[model samples]
Target: MSEPETRVASPPPAASVKVLSGVWRGLGPIVYALVAGGVLLLLMGRDPIGFYATTIESGLLSQTGLEQSIIRMAPLLLMSAGLIVAFQAGLWNIGGDGQFLIAAAVVAGLGAPLVGVLPYSLALALLCVIGFVAGAAWTIVPSVLKAWYGVNEIITTLMVGFIGIRLANLLIKGPFLSDRSLVPQTDVIPFKYLLPYLPGTRIHLGIVVALAVLAAVHYMQTRTSYGLSLRMLGASPKAAAHAGLDVKRDIVTAFGLSGGLIGLAAAVEVLGVWGYVRADWNPAFGLTLFALVFLARLNVKLVIPLVGFFAVLSIGGHEAARRAGLPNDFLLLLIGLILFFMVFTEWARTKGWTAGMRLRAAGRTSQREAALDE
Candidate 1:
């Protein structure tokens, strides 16, 4: 038979099913949450179907409202993308709120002065770069401590947020306050300096910048060796070290880059929207962005859709509170409940009967022993 020599390679299994199935698994929790929200609305003496439909139509279906959604979505996307990197590197930067504030402070301090002196576009470019650098510097303190002294970053990052907030206040009220203004705000940047709007909407070029950042980060995460090293270091620092990776550099880079992006969000807010620094302009963007970051399940790409969804909720909740005679606090309570339920639902999925992964391992063990006994 002359050895009948020929070897055949089996065709690869289709990965589409796994990809679709994974997406469905992740979305199950969201579906359950919507169901729960409907039940709660019904219990609250409201028609769940009518109210919910109105909420969506009013907040996202209308042109004006949709524009508002995109306007707010820009910062959420930018900040959440950065947070995603920090999370992927096993670094918890809970101070994005503060980092964002300080970045705005930098832009306001620098951008306002350059308004008439430099070209508007040039000033904007400088503002973004300086804000990024400022954010990186702000984050370095914690990164150094985490990498060298084993300090807990959750605490350090959060505490720094207060400091950052204070710094913003000092600049807005003390240093930069305009003599002609009675309010706690700096002199407004010339109107020519604000970012141009997207056609038919209030959304600006900053949204484009934000989307670009998301795409860049997604590419790095999925395609680059640097990103792979980062993910590996995050998954298991000890293993990354065993593979001779630069653990310290990756950690610093991850945290610093995250801070820088978040800072840019603040700069976008100042230069693109507000036109000036105001002490009371943001009660707490850092906190809101952190919530979006968590809701995204720490996936950089998923964070974009999640931010949009949440922004819709913000607009709807604001309108419903004003028009429906519902308390704003009640809407907040509803949002909190939704977030809580989603988190619980996700936890439950991973801890189902016999726990999926644990059961698979046990089944494999049983089969191996049975074959051995045979």
Candidate 2:
């Protein structure tokens, strides 16, 4: 009798293709967000149509919603992408809220002076670099403490979140205060300073910058030695150390990079939307943005659409809430559901793969046993 040929089951080509589709990965979260909508409609005792109409009119139907989406996208994408860099290196940067507040203040002040003094393109580039530097500097303190002192990074970094918020208020109310003493924010930036918007939509050049950054980060993660080291450490810190990786430098750098991008997030908002640094400009945006980072399963590339999805949810959810007579709590319920999915997806990513392989092996073993029995 011939020895049976050994075979190994592989992931289907379709699985890879499906995963490559942006909509496919996001579809699950979208469905959950929708389901939350249904719950709100039920509770509110109102028609979902009226709610959607109002929301659409507010967020998408008019120029205003579109602009708001762009504004929201700016911060969400930056926060998520920055966090992506940190998370990839097995470092948790919960301080994005802090970093963004500080960077935003600096960028708002810097953006004003740079307007038209340099060519538009050049000024934009400068803004990006400035935002990156400010954000990175914002995070350095916590990074140093965590790296050198063996402090619990999550708590130390999160505590710093308050400082950033306080500083923003100080600038708006005190230092960066609008000269005329009109609004609680700073002066409106000249239209020339604003990043050009898409012809038909409120989306702007920041999206382009974000896309470029996302591509660069993705390539670095998949191709570079540093990226490989980060991945290895993510898998096992001890193994990374044994393999001679510089864990300390990587950790600090990761936080800095993460913080820098987050800083840029604030810059985009100030330049594009508020045009001036208002202490109240972001209003808890960092909190939900951190949520979006998690919703993206810590994948940098995935952050882009996940950010959009959340924007849509906020718009749609608010609409859904009013029509359904549901309260703001309904929105929270939806957010929690989306987060739960984010977590489950992570678990599924790991366990799903493991479970699948195990099943495949079991099936192969059973087939061999049947042949022997026969």
Candidate 3:
């Protein structure tokens, strides 16, 4: 009998190595930003080590600190989810702040009166629905304009957001104004309408709702045919149309979904945390949410952890600034530096400078080999 052929199995591809390399490359800019921030702190005569220690202790080590950090992440996660949908569809929904305010105003204006008149569950559900509808309505005009008329959504959405803010302020200062207070805010919702908190913690049910929405969004984006179409549309609208996708409808739907999510966040914030909406109490969290979404590279899965990190950064920064005797805006400077570095790194990757250098070196090597052969 012939000897059995022996074959050695090839080693598995080094996927783990590639993943680590990618992660390291992604974190390079952040590392650089931290170094630069530390240098700046030293120049300003601040103790970088002490600042970081205090930040960690206050933001993560304490029970109250941890609870507040999680509580703050809820709204940011909701807003980031909305942004991801719009961004994936190649739409920039810059009016998130406006959408948030309008939704909150709708919930406050209608929720107080309806809480007692209707069953508690039904009333709460209706309020959430109204908030969603209101948010979508605010974006419909801009969506239509962008889809059919090829108008610039950035300008239209931004301008409309200012209008929405003004409208919300008017509502609060007028019809929704509470009779019991001088502030420009709606009357508080009945106790039954407020969301219950976890035992011994300020963290409420809003985080649970936000997590549910995140899971649904992740499922849709990863497993559904609609998500594939959206990715194709974002990559190239003409190509998607050639592939028989309804590009306009997808774009419009993206805007609607984005606005609806922001509205839901507004409803959660009012019902779970504040139980009221005040004209002067704009959180202006839209920009921060935008930053967090971009920082996560638009991955829905990454948004959750990134938002939590952002909350920690925010809370810790405050503590650090207080301890260091720095202005409240000092942390903003660090954040800005990090963003600048991220942008620069992205530009470098797009330019492919390192790849070009490698190609040139390879060409030189081939020429040298040809010379030797001659």
Candidate 4:
């Protein structure tokens, strides 16, 4: 009789391995953050479980909290959409806070007056366009310098953001300051003219707009030749130039796209929720989301859940903090801890600790399966 044929097991598919790695990379920081946060709360003589339970009950379980969380996600989703594109192009548009504030100030300044002359819908559309243009315009110097002169975009973008923040304050204080009140804010758009809510819900249409932008960004990144070029540029600019890609144009385009989307986020906030811009009202979503984009691995789909989670923390954690006698800024501390662990994991990955362990585990599993078959 022929010798019995022995089956040899193969290692897990490379794609599956990658997916698992990505998932761990995404979730590991969250796990670490929770553990670290618990320790901090204990050290502070606080009840960690009680705090988390209250936060969950208030932010996610309660209907009002859920609605608020959804509403808060609107601007975050839009800003994250922009950051994805900028990050994909290997560019850092660190000035989103500035872009957001400036566009909002301009939109608030124009929205009320324009609604008086034209139809509200028409005015809303125009304001959105103006927001986009104002945001893109603010990035002109940085984009040009980065594209042509090879200047470090980090410094230029930051400096421009400072200038833009100051400019936004000036606009709210000077030109956009409302005559209706002494407060440093623009005239409010009439409630009737503001973006409408969904049927039987407090959620505004701004979330829909944010989702659409995110979908479009996903499509652009995955389905277009231009996206391939941008990916190549990010992977290695030298190789992209060797491949004859118009490197400068791509850089400028990435900046413009990122800025425009950030601007749209501001417009949506003004039109849908606030209906006016307040001086020194910078939410500074940029700093947190900057770390968050990296945490999401720059994946558009992944960003949705991450942003939702953050929104929930912001909405619910407030109530939890108040009840627990914790400072309101405690959430920021949690976020910073997540960022710290994320960087740690990244460093471990670079040192091959993570990858090596994963590979060895897979190898051993395959060997065990082969031995069983034999």
The C-alpha TM-scores of every prediction are 0.84, 0.79, 0.86, 0.92
- Residue-level lDDT of model 3, residues 1-374, one tens digit each, is 14323312332224454455456444655567777887889999988878878877888888878887888777778888889988887888999999999999989888889887998778877887888788888899899999999899999999999998999999998888889877778999976677778787778878888899999888888899998888787789889999999888998998999999999889888887788898866888787677667767889977887788778878777888898998767666666676777787778767865333344445555545544564
lDDT: which candidate is best?
4
Off by over 4 Å in 1: 1-21, 329-335, 353-374
**lDDT head-to-head 1 vs 2, winner:** 1
Tens-digit lDDT track for model 1 on 1-374?
23323312332222454455456444555555666766877787776677667668877998878887888888778888888889888899988877888888768877778877887788789889988887877898889888888799999998887787788778778777777677877888887788888787678888999999999998898899999998998899999999999888888999999999988888887777788877866646566566656666777767887788878877776776566567655545555655676677567767763233344455556545544564
Q: Which of the numbered candidates is closest to the native, going by highest TM-score?
A: 4
Per-residue lDDT tens digits for candidate 4, residues 1-374, read 14434433554445566677777888889878978998999899999999888888888999999999999999999999988898898998999999999999999999988988988678888988899888888888999999999999999999999999999999999988998988889999888888889899999888998999899999999999888888888899899999999999999988988988999999999999998988999999999998788889899999999999899988999999999898889888888999999999899988878853576578668656655676
Off by over 4 Å in 4: 1-9, 13-21, 350-367
Estimate, for each residue in 1-374, the C-alpha lDDT of model 2 and write its tens digit.
26544423532233334344435345666566656666667565666567666665766666766666666676667667787888777777777777887887877776777775888878877877888898898787788997788687788778887787787677767766667656777655688778888677767777766777778888888999988988887788789989998878877888888898888887777677667776666555665766777767667766777777677667655655665566755556666777776566557757755333444555556665655675
Instruction: Give the distance in Å from residue 48's predicted Cα in candidate 3 to where it truly belongs.
Output: 2.1
Q: 235 in model 3: Cα distance from truth in Å?
A: 0.9
Query: Candidate 1: which pairs clash?
Result: 97-286
Which residue pairs come into collision in candidate 3? none
Over all chains combined, what TM-score does candidate 3 have? 0.86
Per-candidate Cα RMSD to the true structure, in Å, reads 6.3, 5.3, 6.0, 3.2
User: Can you give the lDDT of residue 297 in candidate 4?
Assistant: 86
